[model samples]
Target chain A: MAQPHDRGPDFLERFVALLEGDDVFCVATVIRSDKPGMPAGSKAIFLRGGGVEEFGFGDPARTLRSQADRALDEGRPRIIALPEGVEVFLEVQRPPARLLICGAGHIALPLSRYAADAGFRVTVLDDRPEYASAARFPDADVVAEDFIPALHALAPRLFRHIVVITRGHAHDLDCLGEVLHWTTDYVGQIGSRRRLAFIKEELARRGFPADALRHRLYGPIGLDIGAESPEEIALAIAAELVCVRRLGAAHAFSLRGRSRAEAP
Target chain B: MTDLALARRLLQLRRDGLRVCLATVVEAAGSTPRDVGAKMLLCGDGATFGTIGGGCGEAVVRSAALRMLASGQGPGLVAVDLTQGPGERDGDVCGGRMRIFVDPG
Candidate 1:
């Protein structure tokens, strides 16, 4: 529903509020147009859950809504054609990708740093106070104790990437049990091949769909970079995270054989 | 900088009851310096924060933004075609087009 101009906050005010809440929204600006009434720069704001909040030009509310929805679905900006030779740039504004590290161990330290530098809002979780302390993870946005409780407390929809690097195999299994069901964009688990296979078999026996687990889980995680040290392993995981973030799981193919010049 | 930083600056300016205009590059074509969604905030006192792109293009947008603030006009758009000749100015030789939406608050 369109908000009345006389009452409530103006467009800018509402826009700022959405930004403060880290809500997903789109700003459709009429960047190029041949018409006079709807000249260039005319704009409209559309929220993901809400309809169009404000529109400067004439009534093309339905078109703007669909365009905004498309931008949100595509997760990228694009020029959309409107009525009367008007073209708008639908700029999608999404919150930064959040990284939820299930364990605040040695790998978590450098992984959190690399993920933060790569623009992911990093949240480190561990039951140990000494490990999850703010002093230990100075760069992490959130350092929470109590792994399972903390996982439950977070709105699963907010976290797009999840990393399970607990100190033990049992902890990794427990973390995966809850994380696999969450609405996450990517899930990576650090372990040896034998441990990962054992966990997968255990999860499969426990009614977790084997197909979904195979599709969603990135076990023995990170690219096959042959990384040994904690720092190198963190780099490998970060690289894999970036690959999945940008190219999606299906497009994440091995670049071993392809020429470096031709590889993206 | 991030868009949140720009939004916070704009919000602070609004709270202070200062007349200001926000110019955002909603569309960028070809090889522009900045990507789409880049922003620049211009206050009535001629103070500027953030940047759409440095040099001639920003100067043009800033001048138009000042005019919008002075005239008390509503939001308007400014299209900067930097695909012009080489003798124009620094940072204007990127051979690109940018559509800046200037909104007053």
Candidate 2:
């Protein structure tokens, strides 16, 4: 059997190659240490096929697999036992996140562009053929003429982030009524607090759970960046998304002083 | 090949008059296969040129191509709307969001 380093290039090299290839592979590194067998900067790779390859680590394959599997399973970074002076850091690569912008209004226009810039796969939907046209959102992956059917057409759990910026309250309700009950990662709508309240009341009147509605709905959708322009609003939404996705990378890189090392 | 290179090659292929579907991950908010601009190409016959999110995303692109092929023409642009999931506005729990564009060369 070939060792991770002996196999060919180090995990970092292969990791870069895989990322460049657009292949989903995991990166397992030493985030924290109790003892020392692997240093904090130590790393490994986990492919989706359940294979574990390491670079700059111990000879044991089971340990690498065990650690990588843990990270993949938890969807979080993991720390594994190495030697007395070393620890292992494990980061797994999953499929890219999906951003579903359900309205192709002015907000969707910028949101799609900025979201694409931030690295989220974006799909913009609206009932109006004109609003949802491709010309409006050249950066968006998909622009559709309808919403409800499109939402139902997707594979379950495929959309990780959803933004509702449809034309009016009725459309918002139509889109949210279906989406609110599903187990999506994030669901936000664009409107003032009062508008959302009226919408929520209508939804509740129709028997949607008020608590679930409260927890799932994010009105006035964006971080408070004092954004007034369409482009500025897009920036706020994009910034909020980064705040969510880079959580682990930020912590680990700060700890290791590799803040600029791993990022492109 | 790198996604950037693949994207360039795809554009080259497009210039060659081959209808190509270019798929790219423009945004990802959470644990996802690729980052912004991670791209892939899909030829008319289902020959892949690049990748966007990988895994299911690749699968989705394949289907999108078939749809394009069924329409039958030279390379053009087709956008895939993957925002809503089963009874959900946008599906998937990875919490990351992405957009994939399928286009002809």
Number of the top-ranking candidate, with DockQ as the measure: 1
DockQ of every candidate? 0.33, 0.03
Q: What would you estimate as the lDDT of candidate 2?
A: 0.61
lDDT of 2 by residue, B9-95 (tens): 665666677776655443345566666545577777667755565555567667876677678633222233344445664453344
Cα RMSD of predicted structure 1: 5.8
**Winning candidate number (lDDT):** 1
TM-score of each: 0.69, 0.51
Task: List, residue by residue over A67-177, the lDDT tens digit for candidate 1.
Answer: 678789888888777666887778888787888888888899899888877767788888888888889888675656667777788889888789999898788878888
* Model 2 chain B weakest lDDT span, ten residues long: B73-82
Tens-place lDDT digits, model 1, residues B15-96 = 8889888888878899898988888899989898888988788988988988888887767778898887787546478899
Docking band of candidate 2: incorrect
Please give, for residues A145-264, the per-residue lDDT of candidate 2 as tens digits: 567787787754677678887888898888888787677766776776677677778888877756655434555566666788878877876765665566633332233233222211
User: What range of 10 consecutive residues in model 1 chain B has the weakest lDDT sum?
Assistant: B1-10
Against the hidden true structure, what lDDT does model 1 obtain?
Answer: 0.77
